[model samples]
Target: MNILELAEQNFLITFSVVIGIGLLQGAIMGRGIRSRFPSLKRHARSASIVLLALFSINAIASVLKFAEPVKISVSELTIPETIEEIFTLIVNVMGINAGVGAAIAIFVSVTLIIFLKFANIHQIARYFIFVISCAVLIVVLLGKFTDFVPTAFQIMLYAFYQFGITVGIFLVTKRKETDVLSGIK
Candidate 1:
């Protein structure tokens, strides 16, 4: 495949990887939060599920955008126009030049993560994940790096950012668990 095709495939794989990480993180973090705060069970569970769904949707959008496998257009998609536009801008600016639908997927997922962070969900790890991911996404969306770096490097940076989220979850989970067992009283 040509370099552009390779880039598209790399992005699709990246989105899929993020979805997997998001699901695992959500499940572990959600379970931990509910166990720590029984009163917030409903809110915690719902938020985690939505976070997973957002990532999954983005993965699907990326898949549909691949012309070699299939052709999915923004006009024919069911995702909201605002979401489509945001994704279009990100993918175009980042050099993907396809899959407005995929862009919508990642954008919404990141947006939801930010929203959860400010909603006071009681999980420090959640906030860390949002902050890190948002910083990366915002920089890419701004298209500031287009001229400075190759597209492959940008995609690799994103993959590394997602990996960092997993590490944050582990650190936060461990610290929170320790705090519970310390018996400060």
Candidate 2:
């Protein structure tokens, strides 16, 4: 298949996987894992609901190619006729086409994690997210410098960046659930 076909297939697969996981997690939240603790279960239920929303939003963004974060410096801002075309041309010229969307999404998710932490929504999970996000963000920002970054490292960074968000969500949800149950708040 051609590149466009491959991209379409990838978008479909990613949308499917993200939606399926969200559904599965939602189902699991109702499985009565610890029915004895009502408050803990409530907390878990809330967290799982938020997780579902996040997964859904991210999936839509990914499928629609809205995950990309375009840098808009005040000095470089312009009123272009075709914004998408302009952005595409710029990104193509810059040669950082691969995984730019995912990197931006990771950064956004990391920001949300930090916000959630500061708001005292999920303390335990926030700490884990802070650490993981730091790692992913570092790789993403550093990836802009191809001369300094090796090809193998870029490939690995891409992989890690994609997987890191999923793992972060899972870990945060798990920790939130368990911490609530164990009276850790």
Q: Which structure among the candidates has the greatest TM-score?
A: 2
Each model's lDDT comes to 0.47, 0.44
Index of the highest-lDDT prediction = 1
TM-score of candidate 2 on Cα atoms, chains taken together: 0.35
Score every model by TM-score: 0.35, 0.35
- The candidate 2 region of ten consecutive residues with least summed lDDT is 27-36
- For residues 1-185, what per-residue lDDT tens digits would candidate 2 score against the true structure? 97535645576564455445433332222222333233544576575556545654554444333223333343554655798978965665343464744555555556554545344333443454456547645544444332234344234333433444444444445444343223333
TM-score of candidate 1 on Cα atoms, chains taken together? 0.35
Off by over 4 Å in 1: 1-54, 57-100, 103-107, 110-120, 142-146, 151-154, 160-185
- Candidate 2 residue runs with Cα over 4 Å from true position: 1-114, 121-132, 146-154, 161-165, 171-185
Give one digit per residue, the lDDT tens place, for model 1 in 27-132: 3444444345544433543544554455445545533332122223345545446977878665544445545665676586555445454443545556545565
